[model samples]
Target chain A: MLSIKNLHASVEGTPILKGINLEVKAGEVHAIMGPNGSGKSTLASVLAGREEYEVTEGEVSFKSKDLLDLSPEDRAREGVFLAFQYPVEIPGVSSTNFLRTAVNQVREYRGLEPLDAVKFLSLMKEKMKLVEIDQKLLSRSLNEGFSGGEKKRNEIFQMAMLEPTLSILDETDSGLDIDALRIVSNGVNQLKSDNNATIVVTHYQRLLDYIVPDFVHVLYNGKIVKSGTKELAMELEEKGYDWIKEEADKATV
Target chain B: MTTITKDNITDSLLATVHPNGNSEAAQVIRENGFPTTKHEEYKFTNITKRIESKIQSFQQAKPLGLTQQDVSKAMIKDLDADVVVFNNGQFSAELSSLGEGYAVTNVTNSEAPFSIKDLYDDSYLALNKASFEKGVFIQVPKNKVLDKPVLLLNLVKANDGQLITPKLWIDCAENTEAVFIEQTVSQDEQAYLLNGSVEIKTASNSHIHYYRVQNQNNEALEVNNLLTDIHRDSTFTSFVLSLEGDMIRNNVTLNLLDSGCEGNMYGLYLLGGKTHVDNHTNVDHTKPHSESNELYKGVLADTSRGVFNGKIFVREDAQKTNAFQQNNNILLSDEATINTKPQLEIWADDVKCSHGCTTGQLDEEALFYLQARGIDKKQGKALLLYAFAGDVLEHLKIEAFKEYCIDLVQKKLGTNF
Candidate 1:
């Protein structure tokens, strides 16, 4: 469902991602684990089309469409979603309002009619139960004054609302507690299907226990040095990323 | 610009009809000689240049009849409120529906006296007093809560250098609650001058919410002076939203005359083109244990210029006074300018007083956050601007007015978010 070829990106002329490639098929879940500054978040931001990060040389194709040529909003309309590591607090705009605008925009791009208030509210109520979010929180401003766990859960809630085909969870388990991690991961697992793809980017292996992945890749210095199954995540967690770094250094030499 | 001498202006008004109780104001105008830029109060907003450069005589403009098309532009549809329409500065009884608890009367026929004694010396107030031909006096009785708002629609037709001085005096009796909305709009792009004055006297324990909206055409010039005297235990909340005008100046003086009074002044100005809007607000904490809060924000695009000067005074006898003032601005273009000043004078030792001012652009991070969420750039910018003005709009108690303001702000930004 998605392909990245020799992805080279930078921010302010400082190279971050260099010589990276990855592929994900439909109905499959992929886990990209790395330490800090290993380009895990950068990959998420580049896929989300954050203008600050310039892709100097790369080719990203989503569903056989050239994704690099599209803008962030266009990418989003084309079923590309990035659950942010740190969600933005948009004051004065309620969560429900934001979700409705996003959902309608995506639907409009897909040549579908916009959902009216009654239908939209029902969809929102059904999705809120997945993340165990309070109805009152949806009425408040989006992420404004929300707790860390609440923000993570709200991200999952938005993901559920949009139902993107290629979802990238970038460090989604960073600020969440154990209970919130279970709930958020449970929501992601519930939304998984045969037609959609998921990419779980994380620094720890704790979140993988809830939402198990089909493949595990260790990203070190912007490139995936080792690819394995679910046991690789546990191996990295037990032995740490230092051995992965040494192995990457040896490969470079 | 031709210098307008006091004798020239006074003779012109006296030639028409010397109304009673205006002689003292005329004398003050003669003494002040129409505030020049040298005057501290008239530094940023030079009314002298504004009036002399555009208009010649301060006579009442020829009253024009309104058509079906004009009514649509004049009134807010779907607004559940009592609407009062004024045509060319004259109250149109046929176009008005003022419900109970509201006694609307023309100033000339109303036996009750109409006067503004404290502001007799101020140039704008004195000018309105000297030459105002048509005015209205709206009175709300004691212990009554108005069922709906009273919307005073002040519409100005195409001008032949007309000087419209619409004076309004609102007396909200003790323990009363009411919302008064004054909307000033021009029909065509006529270079007319609207010199307006409103004096509201709120009795003890009364609650009054006043909204002043200036959506005049680009060629119109206006100077609106609002003086509100808030009595003991009364709460006076005011929001002034300025949309467009060539030059608009608002002078708001809120006097917390007695103890336990609370006053709030909130304003938002969305300016573009060469439009200039100046808001000068003064809050006087006269009695002890009174509180006052003031915040005025502005968004200046193109070459628009915005000026905000907020002053809070805690008098010597006013102990335990709490006063806060803030003015924030966002300049979209490099040429867009904003001059903000916050002044606080506390003669009382036991008082809590603070003031702050800032001028900057919109948050780039916030804009990107919206744009990344499938909202286009134009809609993203509008969302950010809406968030910037959210706090002020949130304070509006009336939902219809709030929606109207949101629409105006969106239209000003050239986007509908």
Candidate 2:
């Protein structure tokens, strides 16, 4: 579903992602785990087309099309979703209205009819159950004054509504408690299908227990230094990242 | 630019003064002359030049009449309101219809004792008091709740540089509820000057909603003043919408006469071209336990200018008063300008009062966030602007008017998002 070849990225002329390569087919869930400043978030940001990050070299292909050539909005319309670590607090814009606008825009791009108010509300109610979100939260301003868990759950609610083909969960488990982690992961697991792919970026192995990953890649110094299965996450959590950094230092030498 | 001095303008104003106008206010005008930019209130909205030229031609022209077609064309279709029309600054008996339970008469002819000295002020109010020939007195009797709004339409029909000064006095009695909507209309590209004033006294236990819409022609300049007195336990709410004009200045004042009164004043101004809008509001909390909330938002494009000055005064006797004021502005172009000032004066010891003002461009992060959600730049901008104005627009209780204002803002911003 997605392919990245020698992905070299930078922000403000400072190189971040030096050389990275990854590939994932449809229905596969990949977890990118690393310590602080290991370029895990940068990879997600670059994939979501954040304009601040300059792709100095390399290419990303999604379904045989140049993904980097499309605008962020076009990338979104093309079924690329990034659940932000910090969802913006847009005042005066209700969550329901924002989600409706996003859904209609994506549907319009795919030559589908727009949902009316009644249909949209009904669809929202059905999908809202996936994240266990209260109906009252949907009518309030988007993410304004929302708790950290509510913000993350709202992102999952949006993912369920948009039904993107490739979803990037950037630090989705950073601020979640055990209960919220279960709910967010449950929503993600339910939305997974054979026609879609998932990339979970996290610093802990706690979230892996809820939504188990098929492939685990340890990103160190802007490169994927290790690739394994679910055991890799547990191994890193038990032993910590010092040994991995030592190995990376030896490899650089 | 015609060469006309301040003395010449003052002489012209004195020559055509109304016969039944307030002599004390006329004397004050004769002494002070027209307010210049030196006056603190008129510093940014300096209209001495326009006033000098426009008032010259206005004093020389004859009073122009309006046809029913002109009134019909300017009326909002299907508004089901108690319509009151003023043509050329005079009450149009042929155009107005006072429905059941709505009473309106000429204040100049009313036997009820009235005094203009209590409402007099500097140049604009003084001028309005001196030249207001069509003073309307609209009263909603005790314990009455009107189902329909009282629509006051002031139309200026390209009357060869006529000066239209219309006056309105509204009294919502005790335990009554009413709505008043005042709108100004004129022909396209017609130069006219309007100095209008409205005085409203909301009695105790009454609820009043007043809306003032200034959708003037591009060649028109208006200076409007609204003075309201809110009694104990009464709620007085007002919304001012300024769409387009050459220059418009609004002066709004609210006096909380007794305890437990509430005052809400909101404004939205979307201006472009070389147009200008200035709003000055003052809320005097003279009684204990009164509350006042104000929010004024403006979006200026092209080379237009906007000025806002809101003052909240808590008197020494008014303990435990709560007042909040905020003025926010967005300048869409570099050439557009805004001057915002929020003033709070608290003489009481146990009062809570705060005032804040902000002037800047749109938030880049918010815009990019919207665009990242599949919305384009234009649509994203319109959405952000709509949200910015939502602080005031959300207070519009009337459903149709709220939608109308949303449509107007969307059209002005060039997007329907």
**10 residues in a row with least lDDT, candidate 2 chain A:** A71-80
- Ten contiguous residues minimizing lDDT sum, candidate 1 chain B: B108-117
Q: Write the per-residue lDDT of candidate 2 for residues B1-417, one digit (tens) a residue.
A: 123576677666665567766787778878888777888878998876677755446452234566778777776655667788887677776888677785788765223234333332667777777777667888889999988887788877554545778888888889999888887777556677788888888889999999988776877788888888889999999899998888888988898999999999999999888989999898999989999999999998889999999988899999999999989998888999999988788889999998888898987777767766777667778778888886688888767667767777788776321
DockQ metric for all predictions: 0.51, 0.49
Winning candidate number (DockQ): 1
Q: Chain B TM-score in candidate 1, rounded to 2 decimals?
A: 0.92
Q: Give the TM-score (vs. native) of candidate 2.
A: 0.89
Model 2 misplacement above 4 A:
A225-235, A243-253, B1-16, B19-21, B50-56, B60-70, B107-120, B202-204, B230-233, B272-274, B300-304, B330-336, B358-361, B410-417
lDDT of 1 by residue, B1-417 (tens): 123564465454334333553666667766776666788877877766766666665566666777646755676656688877777777777777779866987775223245544532676677776666667888888898999998888878645536787778889899999998888768778787787888899999999999988876887888888889999999999999988888888888898999999999999999888889999888999999999988888888988899998888899999999998888888998998898888788899999998898888977776666666677777777777877876788888888888888788778775421
Q: What is the TM-score of each predicted model, taking all chains together?
A: 0.89, 0.89
